[model samples]
Target: MSRIGKRPVELPSGVSASMSGQTIEVKGPKGTQTFTATDDVTIAIDDSSVTVSPRGKSKRARQQWGMTRTIVANLVHGVQNTFKKELEIQGVGYRAQVQGNVLKLNLGLSHDVEFPIPEGITITAAKPTELTVEGHDLQQVGQVASNIRDWRRPEPYKGKGIRYKGEYIFQKEGKKK
Candidate 1:
């Protein structure tokens, strides 16, 4: 009944998927990633595609069907290409730069925030205000970007802070005298 689960994940050229019981391992040019689904869903690998199906008609099984399928799709895509998240710094004297294994951020606070870059991920500052986070794992890339943005969320008053690229911050009217 889940439309998303019905669609098989087609492996692209140079990408392959292998299954062992409930665990699935995907290998691609970028890297190899593995995921283990719960007992509610069944995973199978074919010559050029991977499929997920529910074990029964129960609500949990049906819910896991679609969710498992999407997770498998992400695993496949992640092994082939790296995920990236871009961040933009706003406000006067606000900027970011990457030095060695640390990300230095100046958010106009009393002191600069030094964020340690974790392994398996790369953060690049193309410009003082522009930051790009890249990694083969989609989740890690997004989490790191979120952590960076958390340092200084955009304020509604002046929209001054760190924010994801293309994110819109609704500006509020200034205080009336």
Candidate 2:
């Protein structure tokens, strides 16, 4: 038995959750989000709360139980409160701009890089060096942010490149003269 799977998810006020077959929908003040769960998993919603359970006791079922519950819970939380990830651009002339459904980045390369923002995700430019990513899907948002950061990963030599805000890059000292 999975402890996490047995725990009930508390639904916030003004948030409506519905389970239909293998899918779950959460409607909240911010917006509505849906999640596709595995067939083996079952979701139940009571007054002001939701619970998840799996039919079988197999290894796969155990994994699905926890994973599906987490996904559904994230959807509910996302609709209630937006999730955000911040990124910082380091190096000279490195910056980012939002251009109507696209993110234009200038990371010291001669040519600018254009990143297309996927649906249900929003990107905002905080400062000239800071970029913010907001979305409901935790996996997708993290993947997109990682892809963008991979373009110009911070180097250990000078820690120059794009990195997540508040992330530390350990610098290696130069060789002794």
Q: Give all TM-scores, in the order shown.
A: 0.96, 0.90
Give all candidates' CA lDDT scores.
Answer: 0.94, 0.88
lDDT value for model 1? 0.94
Query: What digit string (tens of lDDT, one per residue) describes model 1 on residues 1-177?
Result: 999999999999999988888999999998899988999999988899989999999999999999999989999889988889999999999999899999999999999999999998999999999999999888889999999999999999999999999999999999898
Best by TM-score: 1
TM-score of 1: 0.96
Q: How accurate is candidate 2 locally (lDDT)?
A: 0.88
User: Candidate 1, which segments miss by more than 4 Å at Cα?
Assistant: none
Tens-digit lDDT track for model 2 on 22-137?
77889998888888787788888898998999988889889999888888788888887778889999998888999999999998888999999999889999787899998877
Clashing pairs in 1: none
Clashes of 2: 0
